[model samples]
Target: MIENQIGKRFAEALSDSITDDDRVEEARDNLRQFCNAMEQDSQLGRFFLHPSIPEENKAALVMEFCEKISALEEVRNLMRMLVERQKMCFVKNVSAYFDEVVARRLNQARVQVVSAQPLSEDHIKKLKTMLDRVLGKSALLETRVDESLLGGLKLSVGSLVADASIKNALALLKQSIEKEEVLSEFASG
Candidate 1:
């Protein structure tokens, strides 16, 4: 929704203003946290986003929050840019899409790993290193233990899947048999 509405435009504009890739993350994170808070709480959201609210007030509050983080100058600049452009309404989507762009630049991937058992720090570190090497980029991994997988792990990154779990193997076997049965019936007919 908001992603579709503002993602591309926000990404292009944000990328242009901010050159350092990490600053993109900082801007994105700050915008996201601020937007999320405002969205979840109606009174503040209305107060800040109301058309009647003066730009000075918005800029002051933005500076106050930005100061709390001890963040880079680029972050404050980005927030100031949003305030100046009157685009703070879309800050949430802007941050989400900006992070997506930043991730793309780093060639970073969000890998979801579901294993039959919880992974130890050693396992995660080893896996992270392996993914970075194999993928030729950084990896932001979210690992979870899904006992329903029966055994082994199932990894998914974007559209790619590396399913080594017992449950998936069994499902694959079942599908193969059903396909074979259908083929046999067609041949007989």
Candidate 2:
């Protein structure tokens, strides 16, 4: 919860810094790229979070990288703030929060859909429509095929999850059967 609050603070501060809509979009991309890079590269993530590395050095490294990428000053400031506060490990969370804030500002919902097989455009559209009705916002769906789902699909919107997969259904059925067997054994005893 504290980590979430820290991330939200940074995301809100960054959001407040942007004056133009285009800059907000650009900062979103910049932050996503920066956070993904840190997450994908353990060494890079460590360099920022490592205890031995001075905070100033970490800030300098981030500033240089941001300058090279021509990132918005707001993004650079956010990176520096995270480094100084020893919260570099929360970069991904910050990005997620920032994206949520931007999406809220735009009245759009970003959702992820996982299914046993790739869905057709029409199917995705229908799913989006369902999500729109549920979330009361325009839904933007990101689809992925996960064979492990066995059948059907799962939808994740922010913190909410809607699981309709056969695997989940079977698991629930098994739990119910187990409970019934236990109850019968207790009665017999």
Candidate 3:
């Protein structure tokens, strides 16, 4: 497992170095995209994390990669530090935590919603507005369809899940009926 402190410190360093919101967001995007690439391509991750490759070569490769991605100086420095410490395998974890830091700075939450069917654009917009107001933060919604949902929506934001699906409602009703029947039986006996 990657150490959370390492990612936290790297994100803090990057956050401290950039003051402009646009530039900060750009840096975050650059890191996020590159880390996503690393995650999606195992060969890329292996190449970077391989012990046979010398640290200097790794540094050069990382610099070139960062330049290609137009990463800011702070991001480049963090990548170099990761290379030096031989922590390339933890790039995804670092990027994820870094994104959290950026999102927190922007007062936003990334929400995922699953429904029985695809929602209309207007419905999506209304849901976003409601979530934004209810969360007290800007909501970035990602939607998906699940046929098993029956109807309604399931929203996940951070650790909270709000399930309003007919499936869930039926399950609750069944449980309530079972509990009431048990209570009546106990009283009668």
- Full-model lDDT for every candidate: 0.80, 0.88, 0.88
Better-scoring candidate (TM-score), 2 or 3: 3
Candidate 3 positional error at 61, Å? 2.8
lDDT of 1 by residue, 107-139 (tens): 888899999999999999999999999988899
> Candidate 2 — which pairs collide?
none
**Higher-TM-score candidate among 1 and 2?**
2
Q: Give the per-residue lDDT digits (tens) of candidate 3, residues 5-48.
A: 77777777778888888888898888888877887878888899
Report the C-alpha lDDT of model 2 over 111-187, residue by residue, as the tens digit. Answer: 99999999998998888888899889989898999998899999998899989999899999999999999999999
Stretches off by above 4 angstroms in model 1 are 1-6, 12-32, 35-48, 180-189
lDDT of 1: 0.80
Over all chains combined, what TM-score does candidate 2 have?
0.77
Ranking by lDDT: 2, 3, 1
**What lDDT, from 0 to 1, does candidate 2 have?**
0.88
Q: What is the lDDT of residue 145 in candidate 2?
A: 92
The candidate that wins on TM-score is 3
Q: What order do you get sorting by TM-score, best first? A: 3, 2, 1
